[model samples]
Target: MKKLYLLLVAVLAIGTATMAQSKKALQTAVIKTPTVQCDMCKKRIEAFLDKEDGVASAVVDYKRKTTKVSFYTDRTNIENIKTAIANVGYDADDVTANEETYNRLPKCCKKPEDGGGMKKQ
Candidate 1:
């Protein structure tokens, strides 16, 4: 009985350590997409970020103008994610969209400042 108890404790300790380390390695960040105006913008950003290195997944909510991204800290970071979004032609947090990519985006995805994009609700 004592041997079984010790084994159980050892297993639990290993599980707890594994969970803690994985939690640190994986992180989720909510980034504001100030220029995200419609479904097209959401799809574009999500699709682009989904293929970025270390990004586990990306969810963009155009209505909220926010993007929630899951990534491995050891492989990438928040700054890289922001830049990835910018490269896709949408602003991420304080990072502005890449001007060339922005110009190439569809009319519905462009910022309202450009007299394009959907009207904000």
Candidate 2:
């Protein structure tokens, strides 16, 4: 019975540790995306961020030019999230979009400074 009690104590301790490790807090951050111009841009960024491993959800507001991202802090950090946004052809805070990706965006999605007309494509 002594051995059994010890086993039970070990099991409980292990279970508590596992639970604590898995209980990473979810965090949300708002990043400005100055270049996002239309619904298409919003959809693209949201879809891209949503597919990233740590991201829980992503919402882009074109009028305000911002993206709100919910993510697991244990799995990812804000810089990585911003880089992911840049990877999707949009600027996130100080991270610049990848040049090739930015160039490939539809003209309607590109910023006027990049020679993409703001007028309807």
Candidate 3:
């Protein structure tokens, strides 16, 4: 009985330690987007970032036109995060989305100059 109790305590301690080490917290940063006008834009940006390896969480504020992203610094950095956002047809910070990617956005998502009838950035 004594041996079993010690073994259980040891197992629990190890599990706790492993859990703590696996979870890395990072500071949050906000990225501004000029094309964030509606729910579709928010969903598209959030979904894309959520699939990235280093991103811990992403929240888009349409009214404020900013994305609050929490990412693991070891796995990714702010530049990568911004690039990922830009790849999905949204401008992040000072980096503009690639022209091809921006052109591929849905009609409503396309910027005004693209002839899709959306507002100009």
Candidate 4:
């Protein structure tokens, strides 16, 4: 009985240590998207980012032209997140958007440099 009790205690201690090691804190980043022109741009970027691995949430403010992203650092990093954003036709900080993808964006979502893409309506 004593041996069994000691084995159970050891198992529990190991389990607790494993659980603690796996628990990672969510990190947040605010990335600038100077080309984000309107509501559509905001929604598109936020929705795409939310679907990425390790991303907990993403919110884009059209007025501010910034995206606030929360993600688990263990599964991904800031550079990966930014690259994902750029892949979806939106620039994240110093990362430039993919030209082919950016060209395919809706007229209102494109940057002014790409032929005056902002729509007032």
Best by TM-score: 1
Q: Which lDDT tens digits does candidate 4 get at residues 8-94? A: 999999999887765655788999988888888888888898889999989899789888999988898899999999999988899
Model 2 scores worst on lDDT over the 10 consecutive residues at 112-121
lDDT of 4 at 32: 90
For candidate 2, write residues 1-110 as lDDT tens digits: 99999999999999998888766568889999999998899889988887899899899999999999988888999999999999988889999999999999999899
Kindly indicate the candidate among 1 and 4 with the higher lDDT: 1
* Local distance difference test scores for all models: 0.90, 0.89, 0.85, 0.87
Off by over 4 Å in 3: 1-25, 113-121
Query: Which ten residues in a row are the worst by lDDT in model 4?
Result: 112-121
RMSD of each: 3.1, 3.1, 3.3, 2.6
Q: Per-residue lDDT tens digits of candidate 1, residues 1-121? A: 9999999999999999999987889999999998998888888888888789999999998889899999999999999999999999888888988999999988888877798878557
Q: Locate the minimum summed-lDDT window of 10 residues in model 1.
A: 112-121
Ranking by lDDT: 1, 2, 4, 3
